[model samples]
Target: MLACLLLAQLLVAFIGRSVGPLGVLIGEDLELSKSQIGMLPAALFLGQAIASIPVGFVVDQTGSKTLLLLISLCVGSSFILMTFSHQFGFVLFLVVIGGLGYGAMHPVTNRGIIHWFQRTQRGFAMGIKQTGITTGSALAGLVLLPLAAMYGWRQVVAAACLLLIMGGVVSYTFYHDSIKETNQDKKNLASFYGSMKHMVRNKPLMLVSISAMGLSGSQLCLVTYIVIYCYEYLDISLFLSGVLLVISEICGSIGRIVWGIISDRLFKGKRVIILMIISGIAGVTSMILAFLPPSTTFGVMIPITMVFGFAISGFNAIWMNVASEVVDTTFSGLSSGFSITLGSLGVITLPPLFGFIVDFFGSFTAGWIMIVGVMILVFMLLLLLLLEIKTRAAY
Candidate 1:
């Protein structure tokens, strides 16, 4: 089941990230400005944000496996349709459709982990599961970009569609819901609006969601622009820049596992405090990245980028786990849905903002500063969350 969930997430992530490394090529082909190119990811995230709450309600009615299967088909079909996109608007439309499919994986898969794993191991399990995101991004960095460079972008999308089809088959064959639904769950499902109302009233979950907005904004800026930053600003080749992205994602994958172990063993399930510490470290690294000397060597930049990736991208599973723990077990999917929807506000807004800063200033420095500032804001919010949790515990 864990493997199935990971595979499901990987497929969705692959579809979502396949365009980032190829951004330059696509922009050249389509004659798009940086801001317009940035809108591609924004449109995708907007679709996901639009779908998350409704999909959460659907997951509560159906199960993760069924939802996974349904979205897998949507993702596969969207990729194939992407092969025919000749205009920017059409591409954006396809990306939004793909994003809608990609949106449900978190709430669905995290809910699965909560059901399938024990409390003692849930952090670690979530950490392992969260690697699906980094893994997918790494694959695109390592494989998709190279292939798209050799063939065309259309061929790359077609090839990705084939893999997504296989992923759909794997999901249908192996994935199963661990939770056995009760009659009471069925009765409660009828009051979906009440559940949404209660979710709005949960202060901790609301704070977590808001914190996610900041962290996600920074993280998206990093991932969406890292390749372009390296290639355009640092005088790196496209292929080497893609390699840097792969390295960052690899570090992010390791960071998730290591951070999860720390939360489980060292912190004894105090996830928010760990998040607070990691967010501080991440904010520091983002500031450092923004200050990298123009003559900096790839070796120096490599380590910084790795640290940034780990610190920025590693804590998501912990956040999801913390959100789940704050609410009733039955509301795990709904709470994560709220977090995802709210968190996606960053995704919907940040990339184009970053691009606009770069285009206006004619350099990446200001954009990088914006990203780091957001990280600092994220750290402050995490601190508040930690204080609130501690105060409630004292009561």
Candidate 2:
């Protein structure tokens, strides 16, 4: 079941993340500005934000298997259809359709983990599951970019979507709901309004969710612009620039597992300290990026990108675990959904805003600074959350 969930996440995440490596191709073909290119991924996140709460509610009511199957087919078809469209608006529209499918992914997968794993093992389980995301993005950078360069982005997208459809079918065949629904369990399901109220009142969860907005936004900016930044600013080839994304993602994948182990084994289920450490690393890295010289070597950039990826990209597993654990197990999906919805707000807005700042200032420095500021704010929020936790323990 964990393997199936991971595979499903990997397939769906590919389409959304493909925008990063394929941005230059799409922009040149469509005659899009940087801001417009940023909008493509933002649109995807918008779909996610729109669908998250509703999907969360549905996943908690139904099981994850059915929803996972539906999203795979539906999102795969949407991206396949997207390949047929030449107009930017039409392509963006289809991306949103694909994003709607993605919105349900977290709620479904997190619910599965909550059902299958005990708290002692959940951080590592969630980490392994979250690696699917980084691995998918790495695949995009490693495989899709080269294919798009050789065969055109449209062909690559269509081919990938087909695989996604097949993966969905396979996952549906093997994955079953771990938790059987009883009459009592069904009866205890809260109304949507009641669930929202409970989630909103979860002070630590709410703080974490709000802080995540910054992290999500900063992470997206890194993914969206790093290729372009390397190519244009650092005088790297497009292929090599894409390789940098692959490196970050691969490191991010490793970081997810390491951080999870730290939380689960070393910290004994503690997550906020991990979050604060991640925030600090991300902030420092962003500061380096803000002041990076054009003459900086590719070797220097590699380590910096690795650290950035380790924090901004790798923090999700810990964040998701914290969010789900704060609420009742029955409402885990709802809590995950709510956190994602808030996180998506940052994902939706930050990339384009980063682009706009770049365009306005004619430099990446301000944009990196913006990300740095966001990380600082996230660290402060985590500090407050830690204080709150201590206060409650004292009481």
Candidate 3:
């Protein structure tokens, strides 16, 4: 069941990022500027951000299994709709609606995982589950560009619609909810509202949400720009750049699993501490990459990017673990969703802003510096969060 949920999320991520790998071709087809090309992802994040809170609330009220099936259908249908779009505006609209389905996955799927896994096993489980994003994105990076090159980008999207439908079918056929819990959830209509109020008032959850904004923003910039950055800055071939991006995602997939084990065993589930350490690593790596000259070999950059991938990509499941730790079970979905909503601001704004910086400065350096600034902020907040926890513990 967890695997099915993960597969569904992986497919959703593939759909969410469908525009990115093919950005160059899509841009040429639509006659778009760099900033406009960047807006494609921004629009998807925007739609997901808009839907996050409401979907979180819904997840708390209903069964995640049902929501997963429904959202999968929505996502699959949106991809089918996207193939018919002739204008950028229309594509953007479909992406936004598709994003609503994407938004539902985190809250619904994470809650479902939390329901089944014990606390001792959950970090690892969540880690494995979160890999769907990097794995799917990685697969898309490796597969989509070549397909677009051979068959045209529109046809690739049409093919994606079929895969997404399979995800929906798998979710409906195999995924099961806890019937007793679902019945209990229906009995407490007021608890759903109470959960919302609780999440807003919870200081730890709010801090995690704010931390997520920085982490997510920095990570989004990496995912959105790395291919183009390699093409324009390093003069790498588009196909090779896509391969490098795939390597990063594959490394990240491994990191997610490894970090989960470490958090569960070495740290004894001290996820926030792990988050702080990784944030520092991610910050330093971003700064290093930012200042690298065009002459730097891809060999050097590859290992550095692999490290960046390890640091940034590993903590996603940990953040959810941290959120689930702090909140009650009844509000777990709400807390996770709320944090993602706050975090989506980074995804929504950063890509275009990075592109604008690139356009204005005519280089990738300043945009990476922007990411470094966010990482610094993230580190400080995590430090403060840790200190506050210590102070409360001492009291």
lDDT of each: 0.82, 0.90, 0.83
Per residue, candidate 2 scores C-alpha lDDT tens digits across 1-395 of 99999999999888778987799888988999989999988988898998888888888887888888899987899989988888999999998998999878888898888888999899999999999888888899999998999899999999999999899998889998874422215424447788899899999989999999998888889999999999999998899999999999988888888999999999999899999999999999999999989998788899999999988999999999999988888888889999999999999999999999999999999999999899989999999999998898799
Worst 10 residues of 1 by lDDT: 179-188
Using lDDT, give the best candidate's number. 2
lDDT of model 3, residue 49: 87
lDDT string for model 1 (262-300, tens) is: 999999988887777777877787777677776766777
TM-score of each prediction: 0.96, 0.97, 0.96
Candidate 1: give the clashing pairs: none
Report lDDT (Cα) of residue 55, candidate 3: 80
> Poorest 10 consecutive residues of model 3 by lDDT?
180-189
Q: Please give the lDDT score for candidate 1.
A: 0.82
Ranking by lDDT: 2, 3, 1
**What would the TM-score be for candidate 1 when compared with the true structure?**
0.96
Among the numbered candidates, top TM-score falls to 2
Clashes of each: 0, 0, 0
